[model samples]
Target: MSPVAAPAAGPSATPSADRVADVRALSDHLPRFFRLVQALKQAAGVDGRDRAALVLLFPLVRVGPLRQSALAELVHADPSTVSRHVAALVEQGLVQRVADETDGRATRLLVTDAGRAAAERLREERTAHLAAVTAGWSDDDLAVLTELFGRLLDDLTAALPADSRPAFPAPREKP
Candidate 1:
């Protein structure tokens, strides 16, 4: 019998000058943008002790209770990695795991009263910060800024490579 042929390697992707220019523009704003997010997180009392905890808890506050696997998917982290965060939250009395009715072996995570309180604090801090930062702007301008920033994030995330550790799922079909 003839030997089977090996799969061909894909072409190497390289960015052109235009792409470089686009990247440079983004790079120029990245430091300030990240610093702002860091400052906000710090103001909300998210420290080293709760870095991963904040990541896990923030989404829960926004989206409500979720299966451990689903939470992992939302965070773009492995199940084991998410489990560790959940464990920590549970130990701190901030999150509780309840057995799924349909599947006893499966569990859904719910934020406890303490978790809700913490999440509220974070939300308030963010709202106050945004309000203060945009104090000089009109309501219409603030609305436009919010809409545009979300759109920009969507566009940039869609443009990212698959290997990138996305904060959420990509807008594409999974293989």
Candidate 2:
């Protein structure tokens, strides 16, 4: 795949006028957008540490049951971190460990009904929040933005070197 642009410190790193302006705008805006999303998830999530735990439910809820190892890879979290989150979720009855029918030694994490309710509540809350935030935006505008944002994310992910690490690896715990 082709790279989007050159890296800093490279002799070819100089940007043309338009690309520089667009890149600058993205650099300024995307972080704030991400921060708002994270904050919204935290606020809408159950409480305290469960806030983080609840966030983990999004992937499982979206894709159905998954092994802890697969879930960690999908979420780009460390195995130990995923284990802790899964433990808390199981304890809270939001998720359960079930024997993987194909492999007696392995278990899949399934979201309980309570977990679905919590996830739905968080989804609704986020939807309401965004609707309010985008009150001034027209349907056409929203559609355009959605399409553009999706394309941007796809391109960004594609731009990564195949050998590079996943985007969000949770730091490993200390010994």
- Specify the highest-lDDT model's number: 2
- Model 1: per-residue Cα lDDT over 1-175, one tens digit each: 1222332343365655665676587788889999987776667675754776756788886677789898888777888988888899999898999887888888889999999887787668767877798999998877766765666777787887765645554233222
* Model 2 lDDT per residue over 1-175, tens place: 1224445676577866777777788899989998986776566655656777887898888778999998898777789988998999999999999999999999999999999998888778777888898999998887767766767766776787765444343322332
- Runs of candidate 2 with Cα error greater than 4 angstroms are 1-16, 41-48, 162-175
In terms of lDDT, the poorest run of 10 residues in model 1 is: 1-10
Candidate 1: residue pairs that collide: none
Give per-model TM-scores: 0.65, 0.75
Best by TM-score: 2
Question: What TM-score does model 2 achieve against the real structure?
Answer: 0.75
Q: Model 2: how far is 96 from its true place, Å?
A: 0.8
